[model samples]
Target: MGSVTVYGPPISTAVSRVLACLLEKDVDFKLVNVDMAKGQHKSPDYLKLQVLSLPSPLLLHHRTPTPSLLVLMSLILTAYADRGNKNLLGRNGGGPAERAQVEQWLEAESQSFNPPSSALVFQLAFAPRMGLPQDPAAVELNQAKLAKVLDVYERRLGESRFLARDEFSLADLAHLPNAHYICSAGKDDMLASRKNVARWWEEISTRPSWKKVVDMYSAPPA
Candidate 1:
């Protein structure tokens, strides 16, 4: 039981990640809705509470903007990366090592997979809702980038079956929402073409925890 304040618009992959973690741990937290649709996330109230200062990477470089998804991710790990039995992250201080590996693969997922693919889906789906037209060139670029990431995932998953070793960890949890979002945006059949990644996804997606996070709350399409 933690007084966690999750500040972000619902339906984002990041929010999904945190929600899945809370469900898995059977922990309760308050959800603050910063409707990105109405520009609430960028408003001063939300920004002061959730995005007050720069994160660890470049403390002085204020020019670099922090993504809300990344911020929520950090919050999730900080809260649930510990605790017993529900310690899905790892065991003991070993959880630390595993947690670091989780960070590694999650970074890979975000850098190599999430950005371009998400950009494409956002442009096709959310942008239009936000009064922007679909840009075909961006769509193509996103598809190409996703293809390369899938190729890498296909190989990596062929070995371990999950991002961490045999057991489930926050690493796998972190990517689930992104995977769901990407697949739901009509990339399921496309990304599923990768044998190992597809197999891996099959295993993780079935977890009861993920369903609560994924299907329970999705932002309605505008």
Candidate 2:
């Protein structure tokens, strides 16, 4: 198979999530940076490839953009399971029940964790970087929402080492990018304050795949 190409800036949570998945699967891939700041993502040529044209990270294997983040990650798992990350979707060494549980947590991350975490990351981390004013009301509101979600996570983690019952599946992987930024936003207490959640976060965040993505973000531009 040709090397898969992922197009988007590393700093984008969606892009970084894909990158980390590729890494975990041990899939060989290339990253083509999209400069959102220069309006390149909205360019006519880009829109042809990605109709949504928003946080658009096109996976080149399909020769078209997979607009949904979940779809893109599912595609990666389908294409690269032999590369040895099938358990991410609970395909290897995991039964149907376990697979269902993995999906459950993936949904939880999308519906529960993502909303407030994304808001907090943007309001606290991205806004200042773009010279946009921080809305205290937004921050306060998201913080409360996120705290409630983390509370659920805290209890869940107590029962399992990772979100989907002791395995670090896509369930946990999905949260890395935004959680990283939330930590940078000085709101890591949201995770750190919860004992079980803190332990789970440390294990997943320190994985080699995610560490590589974080290093790419920290590295000086080429």
| Top TM-score prediction, candidate number | 2
RMSD of each: 5.6, 1.5
Off by over 4 Å in 2: 91-93, 220-222
Error of 1 at 171 (Å): 2.0
Q: Which runs of model 1 end up more than 4 angstroms from their true locations?
A: 51-87, 91-97, 218-222
Q: Kindly list the per-residue Cα lDDT of model 2 for residues 38-107, writing each as its tens digit.
A: 9778778777887565664788784666777778888888777688666796648468899899989988
Q: Count the backbone clashes (under 3 Å) in each candidate.
A: 0, 0
The lDDT values for all models are 0.65, 0.86
| TM-scores for every candidate against the unseen true structure | 0.77, 0.94
Best by lDDT: 2
**lDDT, candidate 2, at 181:** 95
Candidate 1 lDDT over 102-193, as tens digits, reads: 67886887678768767866876577768988888988888888888889888888788687766677777767766776677676875678
